[model samples]
Target: MSEFGNLVDSIEIPLRWGDQDAYGHANNTVYFRFFEEARITWLDSVPMKTAPKGTGPIIIKTSATFLKELNYPATVQVRTYAGKAGNTSLESWYEIFDSKTGVKYAEGYAKIVWFDHETRKSTRLPDELRALAAE
Candidate 1:
């Protein structure tokens, strides 16, 4: 919970050689992928009950701010924070830092809505998920 508090969940992602851009730093788009990994990992950690039918979390919007450049041969620690939760939507924040030096590389947030695949509409979040978000 450094700066972006309550996003205590974290995962480590190793930078690959191909992640680097022509300029030698990690591609900007790769940070979004890191955030995605953190978000999915965090959500997966929360135990939830079965949904009504074909229901799952879907990201409606996402954005990231580049703070520092990242290169290959490094590991990043991605941290996730679950923000406010509404009836069917919630916001998640993320931070990517050099695992060894603790230097921040990027930060981002995502708005997620619970959706029913079958009905093709937004649905209320499961109780378990809501509880997890509250934490």
Candidate 2:
């Protein structure tokens, strides 16, 4: 198994009934939202001089793997870590695990490309972002 950085950030989300499928387990698509929360948590951890210039990395790809079932009446913890921060893109990994068991219920990764909003084109990640991710 690839050992990633320690728990960089986390978000607790309440389980909604609608989050479950007919089988009474959390729907597969809902895992993406959990991943989103983790990403936002990581972004929140990194203090910014400005609001990312509203033109930095943008989500380009995402994938999820389900390991176990999660149901309503349960609170989930989305743990986050930086997997690979590249020159033109970065990858973030997430684990939605039971807060008590620490057992991962689901996991996923997202790849994002840095973009120049003004030009509407992709660009290499800024040095400051690279440094922040290094930590």
Candidate 3:
């Protein structure tokens, strides 16, 4: 358990040269990608059953707040945490830090909704996913 909630997962991603912009720092959008990677990794690790058409965990909303500029030649660790759960969605949080220095660089949030592809509508959050909420 951590401040954000139950520690779901963490991953280290090496910053690529293309990730940086003309300012020599990572673009804001890149942080969102880092968050997405960590979040998807966590979901994949969960041994949950597949729904119809395997449609699941669609991100309804996502946000990232930059605390510090990210530069290349560095490895960033993105930590994912479980947050609150709703009827058809769950909230997840993220923290990005320098792997070597442990200096936090960004924070993020994402709301994932369980959806049925055939129905093309939101569905009830699975018990396994709902259980991921902080208790």
Candidate 4:
């Protein structure tokens, strides 16, 4: 797993009206998008390796643990980090927090497996890639 020093990567997202649910807060599904945006942004900013051009990584498993509610007109700061690295997959963790208050509103994690474009099967993570992540 990569050791980052409280290195938070964030993006500003406006709560859409459609994002609301019966609970009167941003719908749970929207949080996934926020998490995705955060993770992509973080990856783009860092010197990290991505799954090759055509083939993309697939989520083997995913989970979310909601901590609190988020309302409309609020901007969320989504944060992401690489948590655990494995032979064929890596664990990614995320958190959505209030942009102003910095209070964590939701947290989630995903296990992504690399794949070969042509073979359409899962592949082991490259050793160099793992080492890069560890740094």
**Highest lDDT against the true fold, candidate:** 3
Alpha-carbon error at 98 in model 1, in Å?
A: 0.3
**lDDT measured at residue 97 in model 1 versus the true structure, 0 to 100:** 94
**Model 1 C-alpha lDDT per residue in residues 1-135, reported as the tens digit of each score:** 344546549899999999999999999999999998888888788877776577998999999999999988999999888777889988788989999999999889898899999999999977766665643
Error of 4 at 64 (Å): 0.7
Error of 1 at 116 (Å): 0.3
lDDT of each: 0.86, 0.77, 0.90, 0.72
RMSD of 2: 2.5
User: Which ten residues in a row are the worst by lDDT in model 1?
Assistant: 1-10
TM for candidate 2 is: 0.85
Error of 2 at 81 (Å): 0.7
CA displacement after TM-score superposition, residue 24 of candidate 3 (Å):
0.3
> How do all the candidates rank in terms of lDDT, highest first?
3, 1, 2, 4
Error of 2 at 86 (Å): 1.4
Worst 10 residues of 3 by lDDT: 48-57
Q: Which segments of model 1 are wrong by more than 4 Å?
A: 1-5
Clashing residue pairs in candidate 4 are none
Q: Which stretches of model 4 miss by more than 4 angstroms? A: 1-8, 45-53, 126-129, 132-135
lDDT of 2 by residue, 31-69 (tens): 998888778767767765553556666899999889989
Pick out the ten consecutive residues of candidate 4 with the lowest summed lDDT. 1-10
